[model samples]
Target: MEIVKGSGFIPGDLLSKINSPSDLKKLNEDQLEQISSELRQYIIDLVSVKGGHFGASLGVVELTVALHYIFNTPYDQLVWDVGHQAYGHKILTGRRDNFHTNRVYKGLSGFPKRSESEYDTFGVGHSSTSISAALGMAVASKYKNLKDKQHIAVIGDGAMTAGLAFEGLNHAGVENANLLVVLNDNCMSIDPNVGALKEYLTDITTSHTYNKAKDKVWELLGKISKFGPNAQEIASKIENAVKTSLLKQSNLFESLKFRYFGPVDGHDVVRLTKVLADLKDIPGPKILHILTKKGKGYKFSEEGNETVWHSPGLFNKDTGEIIKVIPKTPQPPKYQDVFGHTIVELAEKNLNIVGITPAMPSGCSLNIMMKAMPDRAFDVGIAEQHAVTFSGGLASQGLVPFCNIYSSFMQRAYDQVIHDVALQNLKVIFCLDRGGLAGADGPTHHGAYDIAYFRCIPKMIVSAPMNEEELRNLMYTAQLDEVKTAFSIRYPRGQGVMVDWKTPFKKIEIGKGRKIKDGKELAILSLGHPGNLVTEAIERLKEQGINAAHYDMRFAKPIDEALLHEVFTSYTKIITVEDGCIIGGMGSAVLEFMADKNYSARVVRLGIPDNFIEHGEQVELYEECGFSPKKIAETAIEILKENKQTILKQGGTSLHDKQA
Candidate 1:
């Protein structure tokens, strides 16, 4: 690693000469094109070792270089939608030195962060937010009379298909905002994009008649401009009339009132730079449709599975083989894979069961199920709001719909959850993957609020599985006819503890919890995968002569009240732990339950705090947040010492008993 970094990692590279957009401006079109190649190589080399987002960044290398070269960024507002593609943007914008440290603990963030750099005008992780954000910046600039400050939203074709993107387009078109929506059409967003917009864009790109007619109309309009002021007015009328007729069959952006520009070669940095420079003079909301290959430079990434290459961990750059960090012992499958396998297993038995993922079939491992039951499984592209309501529609019939979405992405459709599913009392099962510290992807991707968000909604049953076996049972139980309310099963990213996780399925009682250990003095109640951490803490505490009782309270919403009553009665010192934010999470629910029951037990809540947690390894983040095994053990010991001190201070009359 040191050899790779020290041996002219940047000094020999073209990127070393370019620090900021200013450096990019110094280079000619040819030099800039050369720099784009260098930039792509740099990303591949670094990401192959560091392992951040792959294909998206690779796809946008030329576009990133062109945008930076053409626009005076930092001074001008440049918003990147789904900032995963902004790796080249990060490198060009004074982060080349720290780029290798990407997505590491306390290192550079994988996505764009406003606090990280001024050039990153809007921080992003989730998709389809760029247009609205860019428009907001553009509108603000307009209000301030900063006409020269260009606000460009570099969004992918997949993000462009999102409903929010259209909402931004609608407003920008009406307001005539100076916003440039650069549509980076690679026809992919994690998985290949689906739905009407992709098809429409494809049709426009392929149609020779549409392009020929549009080009002819523009030529006539340019010729009319040569006449005079009266001739120019006539040209404008003729151009709009011709464009209206020609574009009606082709352009959707024009229909929304945006002056649509391209289908230009995105990889050609010189061409892209020229187009962008020309677009600067043009007024109102505009879209530049640029076509680029997803994994342009790398043969491996281009030829290999694009979905797998999107964010594959460390890999061999030359051979294109993924480098697996193997443990001494066999490791368990990822929680996503577990969910994928479980859903397929359950779906096989139940004919009414259908699987749905919002443009995340590959991400959530729902492709495994999709492959098995193509008709039954659906990939609704980048539309969380629609996905929720669609699931409600599916459940309106007797069919059981398992709507799988990442916990962070699921936040986009909170209103839909309330209005469409919960209000309707639809028995739609929301399988929220990445339901904890979504490491490396950072705070934007963390599933920190789902417990808080879903538990509060009336008729919503929120459940988190401790292991793969439990996850299977919860899915099985959720589909039961007796369960008529909206159900949510949230699980963390990465692997579970169970190696032989394919245990025989059993019917788990809803709202019930199981006691893991019986001990005196203190009782530990844990929710979800964090229970594995708590159990480890308990084992380590036993060595210190501290016997702490433990309970795996699976259900966060209809929490084990029966178990809590027993816990409050038996144990004076209670510790409630979860993987979610403490404010309105599982721990808070327990506190509320204790208060309602009038139990005066001293409760210590251990979980993520009110603040947003940044990216890192999950265990490292857990430790920092005071929820790791070592931290939990230390906390338990401290609690025991405090209790012992209070008893000693009270002259042997236990304060816990007195309080109780």
Candidate 2:
């Protein structure tokens, strides 16, 4: 690393001079190996302190360096599938200095943002998008008569399992476009890749039969010079004969008309650069399969659990020890963990219950049940739509399918939810994790829309838990025979409220809300974990001599109309808070209820605003969205201070957009 008259350390020698791909172009191909090392080290340096994605970028150091070195980025179009491994790409493309701010509030985003850099062709957080996106750019390039332009989609093998990726590949093969799909086969996503595709890829990547055939063909090509002009044709024929026999069914990419290239070493920067340069000259759609380890360089990440190292918050780079802050007291368990344990408990009692997740067993803690009862759990790889539909299939039988999906990812499977599950009126327990603002991942990952989206769906019971106990109760209730049809239980990413959350299983009556406080002033209705915020806000309001009523409105769909009626009759002033969008959310349901009953109340809805919320801490994002305890209290105080008649005239007549 080099100081280079800067405040902090920057990239070393070859890397520091190279501001962009143009600068990288100035260096000889031989120097790229050194640049790759420096880039890898820099990523390690920054991510260890700044706390962002770790192993993925380390794994793709060579690929990122080689791609930038070979292609005309910001022009040729290089799109990373998920941007988990694009840290090196960002650093090389004019973000080296500012890389420290990665995933920080108002700093560079954790994932690729088109607005952040011209080089980042697509704004990506989700996987399996690069192939389709790059194919679009390639088709456009062909239309524009830009012959020299190249469009490359660097996708993980884990992402390859998605129907979208296959759809893109199927389309790309038919299109006459200068496109290259670099399959970075690490045999892992966040967790190890699953399904038949992983097995097929494994066979291709590590089969003795394929390896022997490959060596024999290479040897035959080397000795082909002994023959004459027909040697090239003869060699090609021999290679084709061997490939046809061995990869009869396994040659999936080739069957789609893509000129499939080797399962090459992705870490070999020199070979990679050479192959990429050569492919750019050869037109049409093709795929280059390169095998890479998830955590390629760093010792700890390379040896440790790839999933844990995928986004290991912080670490000691020298010692290889992951940083940890040991709290004095036992903290509350993560909501996912609670769900993991609770599901196992339920599945043990009910033989018909099964768990399902799309490429996120560990992330959502489904891995716990997967380990406990292997037959009753599945990890569908990076295919949210498939997971939902597959769960629906399970529901078609007598089995109760607990389909766990992240709230943000569930958006991808909206069609499946509506058509496959909801429309069929199947008993699919949709356990939507990361239910609210997923902090630090920004708009792409925030679980702000599930409440609105799920609530709108017919026969879908949209619900969120205030704490772990509620999560357990809700999970227990959904599995029961009483809760028919598609039921969704949304919960946030972090820890729940209660430390002793492993309470006895209890059943919660659907649509019935619980009152936390009784007050004279406005009533505060909250949905999900954000109800805790209302509790704090109500306490704050009392300090200011204003008493506020609070209700934990658990279910958004069959919303507690009776409970809402009780509150409406008692208090003319109301504040509805939720960790979801103000539009079409629980608050909206309250407004709808108010209008339906022909009641007048000053309804101030506090939640995520109309705009996209950026990356930050959970607290910071809560404050930004104006639903933090402080903001909630302030909004209530303002509402309480105003004259009853004037406030009623302004807001009581209809909904108040306090968020707007």
Candidate 3:
């Protein structure tokens, strides 16, 4: 409860005494406990000062310390599911110096990156991947005859609900792989976990009466088996019979062929180390379930009002009050907020409207709609595939279902979107939030590939809103029965440039693009939040004595040929920019158009690079990727200059010469 400063902890001199897991070997058990306290306090201070995933890191502080102290990391291969809980892992693994720059540009990444450090065994961002990945490593080690090396996967109880986790469990159990799966049961995900599995775990962890009865049964069986060696055989049959019945009612993990261990006290470092030491020697798909509270050590964070504290902004460490930024005169709502509020308004008018999200009610702002219409909005709990298919079922029943999922998370449900929604041509509105470069959360959170992936699917309508007003209108348009096709509207993460919400809802003529500006020398086509950058680029071009036309081609699919034809006829050069991969994105559509029609206008495409983008501030990343207004304008000018040279060389009248 008390505010623990970094100064009170053991100084750097003591920390410097330990370098690796081998270095931790010298520390006594009591010293290891001090190390855990120091590590927890360090995490509290680090996250409190420079905001990242706080609660996840706080909950795993002791576990992380115990694992490092007990196991030979980097060599032993410790894989963490979800990676949000890797802050303490980072601290102990020689990244303590760079922890201050966590999640910032060119600094420590928010998630595990294999290239970042040798200790980070596998790069992880999405959840429920550790078990399968760790098993693969274990199998590889066996194939190479390196059976002495250990493989451990620390997954949360919430992560265990994911079907992939169980699939991995089944395979590992069947193979009898030497793998340790430590289930960190904190009784929460980003939000509290849902579905039948969560409730089952809750029963196992909380049911004292059931546990007592089971203990009594075991004791009675022991007494009966003591009569003779033959009685032991009878007792085994009885135990198996009772287990079979109990498995039908509870304990899903044991049924999946795992030796389920305790729901132990996760915060107790000494106990965890002892258990882990014991488990290390005997392991074949064994699970040690540990119970820990999120935001365990820090009182204020534990009782914080908002999940904003889960990954909070800059704040006062003492009081835990988020530092309030000076309010501007008026601010536009976040794109997610607009989408959330719009869906609720639409749902109010249409009783058939239903909202769904995959463990992201708060992140996607679907919580707003959920609050307004609790019966209609459902949180499917990190199961994107289920959310999509569930929405498909709802749509089949003649209901308008809106499945709100983050653009990054939607990757998990790609097959479902194709087979269940698009192939079936279900009237489901896929509201994709965080469609572009999501800043602090890093590469895994960037919604860069949604456009390319969704565009190829048959019967799929892909659209991006240039502003908050267009976003609202697009959501309204997608709701219409006439737009019965499966539709997706992707918008970025932050506020919508303070745009007023006075724009009335109307169906945008499908695939139609609106020209925001008129010019002669060059044309600029833009989509999503990057349309603002287009406007800025156009202004900069005008200042440089270049006439540039700008168009907000809202829908990526149905390629606005009419608008393209207009630009093809009017302009000598065309340039396209979007916050997505250029390979098969809006720019590719334009290039395909030019190629199909045999139009010869010089075209330039600017977008995210072909490689994976790392963690950084959004502005810094955009500027680095050449998506900024200044960079786009400069690139446009260079392209236009080359266009004039080509015309001159071809003996055609150049725009510059004609103007002169």
In candidate 2, position 589 carries an lDDT of 97
**Consecutive 10-residue window with the lowest summed lDDT within model 3:** 2-11
Candidate 2 lDDT trough over 10 residues, lowest sum: 651-660
lDDT of 2 by residue, 1-660 (tens): 457443276668788887888999998977988998988888888888778888888999999988988888788899998888899988888888888787889889989998898988999899899999999998898898998899999999899999999999999999969999999999899999998998888878777777767655545544555566776566567647755875554568777888776677899898788667656655688888898998888888888899999998888989878899999998999999999999999988999999999999999999999999998999989999999999999999889999999999999999999999899899999999998899999899999999999889987898899999999999999999877788999999998889899999899999889999988777899999999888888888889998788899999989999999898878878899999999999999999999999998889999999999999999999998899999999988788667456757776532223412
Better of 2 and 3 by lDDT: 2
RMSD over all Cα atoms, model 3: 4.4
Whichever of 2 and 3 has more TM-score, that candidate is: 2
The digit string of per-residue lDDT tens for model 1 on 1-660 reads 233353245423567777789988888777877898888998888888878899999999889988888788888889998999999999888888778778999989999998999988998999999999999999998999898888899899888767899899989999887899999899999999999889988987787776776555545544553565566466456647756665565457777888776577788887677667766756678888888888889999899888888888899998999998779998889999998998899888889999999999988999999999999999999999999999999999989999999999999999999999999998999999999999989999999999999999998999999998899899999988889999999999998989899988889899999999988869999999999999999989999988899999999989999999989888878898999999899899999998998988778999998898999999899999999999999988888888889778978855345665
lDDT for model 2, on a 0 to 1 scale? 0.87
- After TM-score superposition, what is the CA distance of residue 630 in candidate 3 from its true location, in Å? 0.7
Using TM-score, rank the candidates from best to worst.
1, 2, 3
Candidate 1: pairs in clash: none
Q: In angstroms, how far off is 40's CA in candidate 3?
A: 1.2
